[model samples]
Target: MGNCCGTVIEKAGEMGKITLEILGGGEEIGRLSVLVSRNNSGILLDCGINFDENGNPQMPLYVPPKRVKAIALTHAHLDHTGAVPLYFVSSKIPTYMTKATKDVLRPLMEDYLHISGYYLPFEYEEIAKLFKNTKTVKYGEQVEINGYTLEFINAGHIPGSMSVIVNVSDKRVLFTGDLNLAETELVYPANYREEAKDIDFLVIETTYATTEHPRREDVEKRFIEAVKEVVENNGIVLVPAFSVSRSQEILVVLRKYGIDVPVYYDGMVREINRIFLSNKAFLKNHGLLRKAIKDFIEIRGWQDRKAILESGGPAVIVASSGMLRGGPSSYFLRKIYDREENGIFLVSFQAPNTPGRLIVERGIFEEGMVERIRARVEWFDFSSHAGRTELLKAIDDLRSSLEKVILVHGEPDVQRKFAEEISEKYGLNVIIAKNGDKIVI
Candidate 1:
């Protein structure tokens, strides 16, 4: 880590007004970064990255290190924390995140570098520098830096995920970073009632602006029944889940419903579970997580993985890389996909061109590889973001003090429709920002 970076590149604004410069995640869901500045000095929120069509890493628009007084991370996801280390390369900027987030983030970043470091800008040294200058903030705690008060509120998107409140010059701005309004097996829904009061500006995520998720109980029941049916038939049930919250959520759900079949977990999920276990205070229901962990077997090595796949008895396997992008899930898939008795249940959002989406839509694993997949394929909507009705309710709950609404972290077309609807219903100024747009409030 370096000391004493450059001078501020931007000028001071009006005392009461805040300038928000969108660096990324304006028109899309990933690579989310925003600069909140007042009087020349400001903080950077979530310097995330996205992958291009060719699978290249895309970082946020670069801002001079001196221009930012602090960097606030929302969670441990790579999309929100990936590019943060780049800032640490030249400047030892204070990076703020929950202590639990810090624990999970290190392993995730290490895994990311191990897999895709060649395509990234920063290296292991930068990641180490990031932690050297790190400061941990607890939920509901407020800290002041450079004349601005920063408050971290639980976002309920994942363990240690937070929605931020930036207070400066008597103006209050809320940035909802990937929040959930519906409770899951892992964490409670985002509840910021006291925090949402009298907000002057609101920057919210609209990931599911147009879609409403199914009932959580119903989804869990369906998932459980499907697993039981496959297990009863003596067939392997492979569940591809995200290594983070989704994998843990699925496990808790299985344990809640009393799924007695042998369950095995693979890939990075084991490490993530251990992190969650060590930070039990961050979880809404750690007892269930403990029970799930106790019941499930963690795949130890290549030998254990092959034995699980070749075992005679029917069992359920939950693996990482939810999209089947890259993980042991693919190995399990290639081995069992050709069998009709086997089932492939996807529990996470499958981005376009991913193997999970390909199998679900076209019965193929990859684009060019046309192997016929006879296994049963199904996708469940276990989203961790607020859906349409929930999003509307959230706005209604906070509209009493909201002045202007800025929508981000969603598709452009979906954002436009959602913006229009929000504007019409609430009669508030709604803005759908682009990647580089700046809004003053």
Candidate 2:
């Protein structure tokens, strides 16, 4: 939508019916999108891209924007917000998201363009246009729109990550966007107990639906120990992290465990962290976050990159393109992969056919064709999504008036199995949504 600050288009009269449609994020992990509407007045939840096994990114099914009154964004990750500016409609529909998300949206968008090398339909100017129509809201702040009332609360996935409660047609619908209920050193866990008020229907993420992750403390301890073993032996410790949340979270975890090493950060993590730190109000403990990253050094140029590579072990390097598909992480990995003393510690979930998963599962990190690397490769689940226990607990808190549960943003098999489990456990109607499934809530 292109037009801005126009008259509110209201959906009048009784709450005839609330229809929820899956535009994307129905069965797969990426391209999460949905439409909630009644009487032809609708709102967009998210429009992200899903990457195929070949590392190519694709958008979900199209939803016409003419009927959309507004767009609500959960966070700035590409999978959730990538298709926003590209899908332009004549009318400029205002966007609702946390300030941190609005702040980081530019860099992430630019990075997507740079990484993909594909010319998206929109230009850089459109990003500014998108921001112009943005109504940045603080966490837990309630804003009443023409057709719905939305409140964004902390989702604990990253800085400014949120779970949204949309009040439409006298129904409270909660959407948890890549949620984490346990607090990390940098993030505050989701507070559904307070924000999930009078929920009528729940659409939640099922990324970690069937799996239970290791305790945060235990995982941190193991990761630090692995890094320590490498650096202590004069080997370089490389971590390929997601630029948005995972990068900063790893730094916080390393700082928390008191891992004293030359932790050099490369790629866009510095800028993302700067934007995150600038908005202390959106952080769980900004002061602590500042202290956590105080000792780390940011890689500035090719010289710094070269120096770090030459310096070798007894150092820790965190780089972007978390999957090791591209970015400085790949260069660093290539330089050290043949050395047994060097270590590559994966800190997040690796999707199928990606380099990260290739290395973690098969000791290979190269793109396309895989090759054995002598360097150490270890993995610990550093996912931000809620595990089965966390998901159940979040759903339980909102079960009072929760009429239906739609599981999206997960593998089809996981969504189906988890749906069955949830339905049986809570005795609530659960839907394993497909790309175009429409249901009345």
Candidate 3:
């Protein structure tokens, strides 16, 4: 791995006030990159890529790498880390993320390159170079870059997710990466530390600001019961879940609750599970995780997948792409979707305009669609992000020290309403970040 192979202009841009320039993920939920600058030092919060209207992945517009000491990665999600390898390929800017994040990210980037024809402009060599420059920092570790200190706090959305804290020029700025307030069976909820009590500038994620998620246990129980019903009727239960923590969480929940039916998993879930198990230090219960992995049958070969689908129902099958964005999950659904006894369990959030959302909302896959999937469709809220009440409580808990509030990583309408409500409740005005907008605090 050529860890160091690029050059970038270095400068600590003017001093005094802290500045944050948004490159992406201000108006939308993806491609999260923000430049934090104070005095002569600056760093990127997250450089990610989002999808276009035509269903293609698109990176944020290029920004000069000058004055950026390093890129502080908060997690391994594509929406948070997609642009890293290519954007930094020519610059080789040091990238920082949790050790667990690095482990998961390697596989994600490799998979992305293999599947994406040209979405990722960088080659495999560039991914290796990005890895070489990437430095893994543990949660709560302080990283110093050009007279500034950066710290990572557990974000609880997925394995290795962290909220970023920057300390510079006697001021502290907190950037909440994708936030999770409820502890899942896989990971603990975001930890609100005493250090997080007082903040000069607060950059937070309001992903579910307007929506309230059901209790974690309740959601799991309902989903498991629905699966049990389909299984008892000799129908297959197809659960489309994210290959990361979502797939693992569904597996653990089913097995721990004594669901005896055979459960099978396909797609990248198996590989990601291996990575998650090897890094049990970041999980909630090591024993439970191991048992969950052992409990499920891993499906790797297409022949095996077809065999499982042909075997006919009475079992639970979990696959990737919670939204029907093309993965083994869609195949599983197509196989058993015609039967009224069979069911498609949506155990995760279905992004707007995605196949999953269409099925849930419209009950049809639309023109040129694969089968109508007339089977029963059920939705379960297994979201890992904080909800409206929780978000308000968290903000209120630290309001006494909150000087400036900025919201990111959410839909424009959802965040705008929440921002107005937050400003009224706390009497501190809220700022909504837009693409290319810069706020000086």
Candidate 4:
């Protein structure tokens, strides 16, 4: 009904009772964790972490580790899996995720610790234990743990990302863990119609519930055109993208659109690309990525970085921390910002207060030193989340069996607007969740 933090919102029913506790990611976009329980045992959905304005790691609300029977990870993104190692400090409960997710998580976890270890509770030992307890599951595989049956289906957000269906006591609850219904060069569109059938409850993400993205083809075309223009004019183009999937997605887009220029990738993107290449089944077309890799040069060390920057000819560099918080992208920006010929093409969401947002909105970069940038900067909506149209369509497809909708992982204003529309159009009960809220269905 509202942002019910530390409160229980229960539907009175004598049979088929299931309880959901929101430990985090209730009214936020990150640090998502949820506990779903039937009877006395519970399953932890995601053990993630959030960042404070000063870039400190903020963990989710605590759920006693003993009460949780198992942990299910939707993907390997830091916001979804960063706090998972903390659970391993005391509990070795089995963690289930896709094989690709497991493989991709190691480098990310290592990097996260290298950056935020001082503020974290767990260490590398716990991370090792976390992996020791991990059990990989493929798409559509149903595995029973304690009293819950979990089924993982492709989420289409990134490679190996999934939506989880928890079945217990004859009730079905679907958790849309950062899903995307839009098709991309990396993964196929998430077709959840078949899996949504007979789902009694839907716990959905509203990351982009208030907006609709432009057609993928149109966006791709425009992005390619802009890149080609920069390359042809003997200028440098830097694309700061997420290391997980966005960086690789952009490379595939460049190849698909026939943008033949010197391409160099820096930061942790090279590691993520290797993980994606080895896990070929999780991708839409791994061959395209392989081909792209053959053409692009990897910035192995400072020597390679300097070589690319010192080159006279035009080149495109793709790097990580899409928001330009702190990565090789930031270093590259400092070198190229004063040049009018260079361009910064941001292909991911720029959260408020990040360097990427500042450049886009105010044409400035303010990390160590504030500088008025002269480089042409543009942002593309290469989000891997379902937009308003896709979200409503998902609800319409599952409306027959959906009784209650609980929205999470969006700003408060966006969730409120989305909740109102769902309530009016579908005439279904909708709840805008906050941290520490429990719901019964």
Candidate 5:
């Protein structure tokens, strides 16, 4: 279980029975991959790239592509779908995801390759080829392949995000890929009502298991107030958001508060939003999205982005490379670091060692200045992941029917903490999955 890769078999002695394996995203927060097999047939969920401590791509130590028959992506987040192209280049398996995910993945992969300035593990041609082989599954439609039935329900984290329910041998396994239970103006809450009746094994994400987030109303209020303060001071408000869910979430928050000051969106977030618009079926509230489209101004090209920064004053700009890695956010940070009047608002979780966390923790500006930016630094807990209370509530809601609970997609300590809470409270079998840990129902 310690190894980062390779095929891990549990209950190997039970020959014809079904089994489950955690290939990635077990004791870590990124690179979500899992394998479910029954009677020689297999389905891979989310072949994603794992980030090293420095937020760079690190290949998994063990991944046997030969056994995989198909890949199903939950969404377009790099942590959830970055390594998908690698599978297309290295293996013969067909990949599955919504059209929106493929639309977002193309430009993101291209950008990744361009920034790294090295030969990508997979080529653009492979991405195209994989798209050709991809089997698009709409939400709520059950597809039966080789005696196994699978269905995807909206996970409410991002556009085209899904929580998968797989049934084999009369047992059901639910794989939640980055879920958000609270409803936002941007997206609707998860559709757990229909799937809650007969869930046997629940594989849930615990990314926010130890914290409590503010209510939607409170979050919008804080965000609007923060923006008002920055705007009144004639300061540029820089929001570092994840390219996918967080960016859209923030946009909805801003619009819901009726802040009509031209909000500019740059980087992959614009492109991703385009994809989301293209795949309207996966979105939670299409009406609200239409309203957002009618109101907001989107920054398209480099020139437009540069002009926005050069002429910045009292406008809300939502730009990505959320962690401030290499996108317009970094460039904007560099430009606005000297201004005491500007404010940088971090609305998403910052992974360790990333530029976003650095800016939040140590307010060092460019050229090694050790002074905090004169502008106010604010954090609003508007995360897409379910917070501690929501997590407990979700578990409590499923307590009677849920037999096995496997915690994944979080740090080891976080998983352990949540697992302990579930065990002590519900008396259910709570398993904190490690990388390569295999569990059987």
Candidate 6:
């Protein structure tokens, strides 16, 4: 659990056995990376890049590059696979992911580096090299590499996202990388079958462990009502969503309800949508996406973006950056801040210190420029992570076989609190991991 930059020292020497290490996703929500090592071979779960001020890569974890044998990217989210190219650029490791993740991530990563204007950590040629090194794995198929057997399960977080199950010798570990038990119109629900009963270690995400989200049906009803209310009032509704899963989910919801309002896709959401379309086979409800693409959705161009502000009577505009950092959402917020007729609906998880949280919680937008924006602000907690109750349920579901539980992807306080809750509630051995912490199985 030490914060040093070297191999974690284990008590009683190296167990000369299989072990799991927390490379990232320890005390934070993003930048999820973990190493599962047995003997001398290692398999990385994810290689995500954290976003810094200005939306550039802030890679803090170091993996010695060469020590990594292969990578299993859980999804295409930047926080899950953004830093993958960095591995290819720096080292020679074969990466594996669902075909959908690769298709979606190829453009997203490049677009991120393009818009940020920061010197890209990896060049385009390097990305091609990374692509060549990547091998696509289908769900449920087990692949053996470097003495470890790996299987990918549907994570339910996003299209093509997966939870990695690793088998090494006699030990088995399941890494639930950003799981969502709730079903969505865009994707199938998670598969937490009885077959997973044999897992020895369950590495779970505690991102929303302190809260419980509304039922999916209730959420959909509220979302439809909110959009309808804004439209009836002749006001513009601005939805700030993540460019990947959240954006696609919102679009599907809008399409499902027969909302004829002009839906403008702006910022990276449009590009990400294109990628989603490209890999339609990975989508859970491909029929719905195809239907929406054919009938309801309208892709916006740069000039068309201004139309959302100027022309409009009752329109639904979904844009990113979801956190309101520096995307079309920020520009739209600044434009509509002073207008009482406008409504801002937050449909994603807003991290601490992000602008989206500030706008919803405080209603304070920037330092006074004379007038205060009094638009009605409402939040719908449609987070992709499992909630507190769901986390406990997941733990209980696996109790019959799981021996040890390792909590990751949350703040220190939250992880500690959840760890205690797990121990008390299930009488399980829990490990609250910090960065670089390792546990032998």
Q: lDDT per model, in order?
A: 0.87, 0.81, 0.81, 0.87, 0.75, 0.78
Residue 322, candidate 1: alpha-carbon lDDT: 98
- Cα shift from native, residue 428, model 6 (Å): 0.8
lDDT of each residue in 252-345, candidate 1, tens digit only: 9988988888999999999999999998878998999999999899998899988887774488999998999889898899889988888999
Report the C-alpha lDDT of model 4 over 47-164, residue by residue, as the tens digit: 8887887788888987678878999999998888899898889888999999999999988998788886356788899999999999999988999877788999999999999999
Colliding residue pairs in candidate 4: none
Q: Which residue segments of model 5 deviate by more than 4 Å?
A: 1-14, 61-63, 117-120, 300-306, 309-312, 365-367
TM-score of each: 0.96, 0.93, 0.94, 0.96, 0.91, 0.92
For 40-105, candidate 5 gives per-residue lDDT tens digits of 447777767766674468644245667676778888777787777777666667777777777777
Whole-model alpha-carbon lDDT for candidate 3 = 0.81
Q: After superposition, how far is residue 195 of candidate 6 from its true place, in Å?
A: 4.8
Off by over 4 Å in 6: 1-15, 52-57, 117-120, 297-299, 367-370
Candidate 5, poorest ten consecutive residues by summed lDDT: 1-10
Q: How good is model 2 by TM-score?
A: 0.93
Name the lDDT value of residue 356 in candidate 4.
89
lDDT per residue (tens digit) for residues 251-368 in model 2? 8887777888789888888888899889887776676568766788888888998988777768899998798878888888888888899899888678888888888777776556
Ranking by lDDT: 1, 4, 3, 2, 6, 5
Model 5 whole-model lDDT (C-alpha atoms): 0.75
All models, RMSD in angstroms: 5.4, 5.8, 6.1, 2.5, 3.6, 3.4
Which is the better candidate, 5 or 6, if ranked by lDDT? 6
Please tell me which model should have the higher TM-score, number 2 or number 5.
2
Point out where model 4 deviates above 4 Å: 1-16, 367-371
Q: Please give the lDDT score for candidate 1.
A: 0.87
Which regions in candidate 3 have their CA more than 4 angstroms from the true location?
1-14, 193-195, 369-371
